[model samples]
Target chain A: MLGTTFKRIIRAGVVGFFRNAFVSLATMLVMMITLFVIGSLLFMNAALESTLDQVKDKVDINAYFLTTASEEQVLEVKTAVEHLPEVMAVQYISREEALVIFKERHKDDQLTLQALEELDENPLGASLAIRAKDPSQYEIVADFLEGQMAVAEGEQQIIEKVNYHQNKVVIDRLSGLTASIETAGLAFTIFLTVASVMIIFNTIRLAIYTNRDEIEVMQLVGASNWFVRGPYIVEGVLYGFVAGLFTLFLFYPLSIYMSSATESFFGSFNSLVFYTSNFGMLFKYIVGSGVVLGAVSSFLAVRRYLGV
Target chain B: MSDSLIRFDKVSKFYNGGPAALDAVDLDVKHGEFVSIVGHSGAGKSTLLKMILAELYPSEGAVLIDMDDTQHLSKGEVTQLRRKIGTVFQNFRLIDSKTVYENIAFALEVAGMGDEEIEVDVPHVLGLVDLHDKAEHFPKELSGGEQQRVAIARAIVIQPSLLIADEPTGNLDPINTYEVVQILKKINDLGTTVVLTTHNKGVVDSVGGRVVTMDAGKIVRDDSGGQYML
Candidate 1:
């Protein structure tokens, strides 16, 4: 009996959905828009994360050493810097490598090449490039670098200069912007989710309202509450399922269009690649949300307005 | 009262502190009896039928259907109670989207009848209403008499012990009304207790059975094997 009733309810629901062709179309369209909002937010968040990572890569401290410092001394400082909690990595540039780089830059300038050849020894200093885990931690790394004392003389630092203070303002501002963007992104996602549910809910309510007389008749006919309500729940779920499929298709073209712009700006992040690679996860969330939202909205609208 | 299929005991209903729709009415309908309720507009005929269907509660006193008090039945119990009684409306409220066969099948479907049973029973009920050929047609395609016949088919498909038809022929022409009244008489002969209400004296007088007359929310006259007289 339970199985029979369930089958009848499902059949009725499907029939009901197609029965009111215009209302069903309006309902599915509204659901598509809602699901689209959610899916677009997923892609936008991926792009935003890629851009922030690219920005974070640009802020680091370059510490230059004196000409007297040995390669071993610089290598020792590099190991020490790597051991720091705040430091992410350290790259040691030898005096010869630095000279090679300088010559490469000045190769176009004949006067600079002549002046450089007149010197008997290489005058370029070895440098250690320090990167911190976070942009704001660069100041802490600078403090650690300024604390390094000279090995040969008192009050004479072996490190010639650290460029962290020069670019400190830019790094700080970038860090602040990244934080703000993350917070705002979360807030926007929540607000959009709430608004989308309500919009879809009202649309469903209106659709169900059109069937008020039918529902009353069904109730009057001694239909169990579930018998009356189950078909509509099925209709709601159909709207969600179809809309989810449409929204997924919508993302394909949208992601493809965004891929080039994202690749140019974020350097390595392609929207299409991200979308394809994460299709399973996206399908699980987007379609799942669509089905859940559709069912819940219909359930609530029926309960509150029609008293079913 | 214990043997009565439906009993209304001193039942009174008021709406929003207004005049009573049913005031201090006590009536009992026995098993397999065709009871016709006759009254003018505002005579509380529809309200009495609504109470029997458990659609409204009495402002005071009690209504019992086959031993279960209407006021105290649980939601599930109410559905079970209603399953024992069939209701018809003046409008012949058939589901417009459904075909004639499906409309009749709905009553059995709501009762959780299986598919094979529905397939067998829907055609039989259609034959009873003499609309078997139009089984697949939607309600909109049917005439007034045909629509009311479909409504009767839906009502009796459940095989309810008591059928409460509130003004079943209100919208029908004389010939169509005569056809509908004959169908009701046929249903009553098939051992279903039918309680009907109507303003048309000709339809009521034709029934020529027990007639209960109401006026100003009260039963002014009740005649056994009587005519429709206001």
Candidate 2:
């Protein structure tokens, strides 16, 4: 008995979908547009997060030691900074290693290489590169380095200078900008989601309203509320399913095209890989949200007319 | 009342403190009886039928159908009650989108009948209504009498115990009206209790069964074998 009822419900749903093809098509199109906007925002936010992470990785404070400072002293300072809870990583570079790295970096520049080769002995000082857990912690790490030099009052100062002075303003601005952008992105996504839900609700309500006569006839013929309601709910689910498929169709190719365009404009950052790697999870999210939106809207819309 | 298929005891229906649509009245319809309710436009004939079908609740009394109080049935139970009592409106109310065959089959489908049973039963009802040739035709393609026949076919396809026709031939000509009255008489003879509400004197006089005449929501006359007398 249940199976027969299910078959009839499916048949009725299909008939209803086709019987009101224009309204059904309008509903699907609106759903697709909403999903597309949501998908694009999600993808953009994910890409922005990754790019910010890369930028944060490059932010660090460099402390240069005096030429007279012993290698052991520099190493000791590196180890102390590394042990700090706020420090992410600390590396000590000797005077000789710095010169070698300088030469390698400027290998293609003849003027810089000539200037480096003309020096009789290495004038570069040993330095400690300190990275903090967050850009905001860089100031504390720099202060600690300066305090170490101050403690060496009677003897020569172990640390000459910290690069935090040069980079502090830029770092502070970048962190603040990223933080606000993230908060704004989250707020915009939420607003869009709520608007999408309301639009879907109104659309479904209108569709049901157009079919009010049919519903009245069904009730008069002694159709159970569920028997009349089941088919419309099924129709709603189908709208969601089809909208989801269309979103996927439009999203993948658009992501690929945008990825390539961004890579060319921004120099070799392949943003497309993020989409490809997470395609399965994203697909599930879009389809699941569509189904939920469709089902919920239709249920509410049909309930108002089922008072009989 | 114990043997009655439908009983309305002291029934009254008021709308927003205005005059009653159905005044305090007591009536009984026994099993397998053909009862025609005749009245003018606002005599509450339709409201009485609505009460029996559980579409409207009496304001001051109880309506019982098959010994079950309609006012107390759950939503599901109300549907079950309506399934046993098929209703036909003056407008025919055939689903315009459906063919004659599909229109009748829909009633069986609503009753949860299987496709094979519907396939067999729909054709039989269509043949009974003499619309076998118009099986695949939509309601708009049929004449007024033919459309009423389709509505009748839909009502009886599920084999309801009670058939209520509210001016079934309201839109039909004299010939069509006569044909529809004959169909109702034939259906009543087949052991289904029929309640018909109409203002047409010719329709009431032709049935010649038990007639209940009403005026201003009150039944003024009731006869075992009566004609249409206002």
Candidate 3:
């Protein structure tokens, strides 16, 4: 019995949807626009988060050692720093490797190469590069390195200087900016979602209003509230289903176009890979939200008229 | 009271403290009886029908369908009650989008009849109304009488125990009116209690059944085997 009722409800919904094609299409278009705005915001936030992570990964405190410092001494400091919970990684760069990198970086600068060759001995110092798990933790790591330098014996202060001071201001500003952007993006998305819900509610209400005569007839014919409401809720879900499909159709190409358009800025950061890996979750969210939005709006819209 | 299908006990309906749409009135309709309610435009004939259908609640008294007071019925129960009573309006309120066959089938569908039954019963009812040839035609394409027939077909498709026709022949010509009255008489003979409300003396004279006349929300006259006498 329930199955038959469900079939009838589905049939009614399908008939109503097609019976008023213009209104149904208008509703679907509105839903699609809502989904599109939400999808774009989500994708933008994801790309922004990925880009910020890459930038943060590049930020670390570099500690230079005096030429007199032995390789074993630098390795000992690297191990000590590695033991700190804040330290994500510590890499020791020898003077020879630093010189090779410097030469490669400035290979096109003949003047710089001549100046480098004019030196009698390698003036470059071995350094330890310390990466912290969080940008805020960099200060603690820097303080640890400073204490190590200060406590060194008077005749052999092997640790030269840590570049934390030079990098601190920029890292702190970037972290603060990213935090604010994330907060603001979340607020904006929520605002858009609420506004979209209202629009959908109104659209469904208008659709029901257009069918008021039909609803009256149904009521007079002894259709129960469920019987009258079932078709509209089904229509709402249909709107959502179609809107979800449209969002996916529009999102895929839009994402690709955006990925390429911003390649010069974000290409080296592997933003495309980030989207591809998380595509499944994104797909589920967009489609699920569409269906939920459609169904909820429809249910609320038709509730008042069902009193008949 | 035991055999009554519908009973109005001191029923009164008022709208916003104005004059009553239905005054304190008492009436009973027994099972398988043909009752005609005749009155002028504002005589509360429609309101009286609505009370029986549970579309309107009494302001002062109780309306009972099969001895069950409608004032106490739940919304679900009210719908259930309505399913057993078929109602036809003057405007021939057929779903404009549906064809004749679909219009009748919709009533059966609302009663939760299965597809096979609807397929069989719809054609049977359409044949009874003699609209078998216009099964697929929309309401707009049909004449006024044809439209009323479709409405009648929709109302009776569920084989409701009670059929209420409010001005069913209002838009029909003399020939069409006579045909509709004959159909109502035939349906009454088939053991469905029919409550017809009309101001047409010809309709009341033709039915020649129990007639109740109302004036200003009160039943001023009721006669058995009577004609329309305002």
Point out where model 1 deviates above 4 Å.
A67-86, A113-122, A147-156, A305-308
- Score each candidate by Cα lDDT: 0.88, 0.87, 0.87
lDDT of 3: 0.87
DockQ of each: 0.63, 0.67, 0.66
What DockQ results for candidate 3? 0.66
Question: What order do you get sorting by lDDT, best first?
Answer: 1, 3, 2
By TM-score, the better pick of 2 and 3 is 3
Per-residue error at A182 for model 1, in Å?
2.8
For residues A1-308, write the lDDT of model 1, one tens digit per residue: 88888888899989988887888888889989988999989988888998888788877889999998888878888898999999988888999999999999989999999999999999989999887888889988888888774345564457898898899999999889989999999999999999999998999888887777877888888888888788889999988888898899888998899889889987768989999999998898788888898898888877764442
TM-score of chain A taken by itself, candidate 2: 0.84
Candidate 1, residue A20: how far the Cα is off, in Å: 3.0
Model 3, span A204-296: residue lDDT tens: 888888777877888989988888789888988888888888887787666576676666776443345545777787678777778888788
lDDT value, candidate 1, whole model: 0.88
Off by over 4 Å in 2: A66-94, A105-121, A130-134, A137-159, A266-275, B96-99, B137-141
lDDT of 1 by residue, B72-153 (tens): 9888887887787888889999888789988888888898888888999999988988999999999999998899999999
**TM-score for the B chain of model 3:** 0.98
The residue-by-residue lDDT of candidate 2 on A1-308, one tens digit each, is 88988888888888878877888899999999888877777777776776777788888889999888889989989988888899998888999999899989988999988987898978789999888888888888988888887964577777888889899998899789878978998999899989888887888889888777767888889888878888888889888888988997787777678888866754435557767887887788777778888888888888889877
Predictions ranked by TM-score, top down?
A: 1, 3, 2
Q: Model 1 misses residue B20 by how many Å?
A: 1.6
